[model samples]
Target: MITEFQLLDAPAVPTVVVKRAEVAATHLPELFDATFARFHAAIAEGVVAPSGPPFGLYLRMEDTLDIEIGFPGVLQSPDENLVASELPAGRIASAQYWGSFDGLPLAWAEFVSHVAGQGLSVAGPCWESYVTMPEPNMDPTTIRTDLFCAVS
Candidate 1:
């Protein structure tokens, strides 16, 4: 669960982008693995310098989700396979979670409520950044994910 929330003006970061137009919720695990694999391969191939932690950008989520998975990076140049992109930019309602990712939905619920409590409207896409990435089979209690709800 979120312990606190904040409003911040965010700046976009360059990324090694992988996006899906449509994805079922059940398919998210595989998508993250494949997308991150591509990110690592690009790193191994020296295509981009890992500039920051990984992120999951959510454009829309209803019957299906519009998503982009990527790592903020300093690209050597634009590669066709890995498009160079940027994360959402502007004002945002932010929340920090320091537990298993399974608690994310609830965290988001609190984040929106907190934003509304402050008289703000969510106006754009949202995203979650992996501030400290968890290793394979790592204890979820140690994870750190920073969520952002873009707002007007």
Candidate 2:
């Protein structure tokens, strides 16, 4: 996997999410699909226009996975089930992964190594922005996900 490292002045993005802890790898697909469906429904109902692609904000990744899955938005949702949160603004090391989600760990490993090699340390939770939505006949290689981990 090819990775790129850059400094970003990211802005805080509001989002509606479903927070989950210790999520099993097998359950992620279903979890994300259901969560995003609810999010899109809210978007359609005029809650907010999606500011960006869907993302999974990783709060914890060791021992157990903790994450919030949802869409970035301009307005907070009135639906109480969808928790409103923000993606913090800061410097980040990022990479674009062009394949299935299963290959993500490799991409992340390379990204983290690059960050450390540059004498930078992770400063916060990492997130994956799904830049391209999956389609029924879409090729896995064509899928795009941009991964980011805050660094300082």
Candidate 3:
């Protein structure tokens, strides 16, 4: 299947994140599901609390990976416990994946190839935005993800 994604510039915003390491593609669905579920629950229960227009979710990776669910606007640093950082403004190459998370790595590979083919270098870490709400009865096959790579 051909994955299609659009590139755009996204501004920095406040986010809440959880760190994990050596994650496999097979288990990513559950990881994403559980991580976002907790983030969503926090929003619903007024735990983390939402501050602005909820649009993008970012994943920052090095040796380990950190998944950050970004809320729109600048969120307050409650008890000064949040790990919020301002991501510098830059160009990004993005694509939309409308399927199970199993195919996400491949989709991201395509994005990387596309960026390279354009003679562009990656500027920052990559992340996937969960643009749609996950339903209990919904098939993972029908889930949607927006993969993004920061570029210069």
Candidate 4:
């Protein structure tokens, strides 16, 4: 399920601690877990999130997905494990998604189709902002993910 799509001016994110990965679709869960684990470790080392929520930047989606996952904030100490980066400024077409993670592929496909139907060109990396992350004992239907695709 998804909410009505909206196009908004998305400002450039100045600070972020991201870990890039190239992995097959089947490994996403483990990839997210490890990436978030790196963020937690960075927090212990003085990284702060003064910007926005956690996000996954979908750079490329082919046979293997190229993704960068992390929180929006400064990575004071750059290391080999994690790098500092920013989300580009642009117009973003977005919608709120409801349900479990398993349905995201279809959701994204639908959303992308809708964006294309609007005649908006995808200008940059698409992303998903995690509004309500999955938790133990929580209903799968309660999950809320906000999808954003940078559009021209």
lDDT of 3 by residue, 88-113 (tens): 45787877778765676687777788
**To one decimal, what is the Cα RMSD in angstroms of model 3 from the true structure?**
3.8
Between prediction 1 and prediction 4, the one with superior TM-score is: 1
On lDDT, the stronger of 3 and 4 is 4
lDDT tens readout by residue for model 1, 28-85: 9899888888888888889878888899999999989998888888777667767777
Compose the digit string of candidate 2's lDDT tens values, residues 58-151.
9998777899988787554467667778888878778788888889889888888888988999999999999998888889899889989899
Q: What digit string (tens of lDDT, one per residue) describes model 4 on residues 54-131?
A: 888888988888888877777776566777777878798999999998999899988988898899878888989888
**Clash number for every model?**
0, 0, 2, 0
Model 3 lDDT on a 0 to 1 scale: 0.61
**Model 1 lDDT-worst window of ten:** 74-83
TM-score of each: 0.91, 0.90, 0.69, 0.89
TM-score of 3: 0.69
| lDDT score, candidate 1 | 0.84
Q: Is candidate 2 or candidate 3 better by lDDT?
A: 2
Model 4 segments beyond 4 Å from truth? none
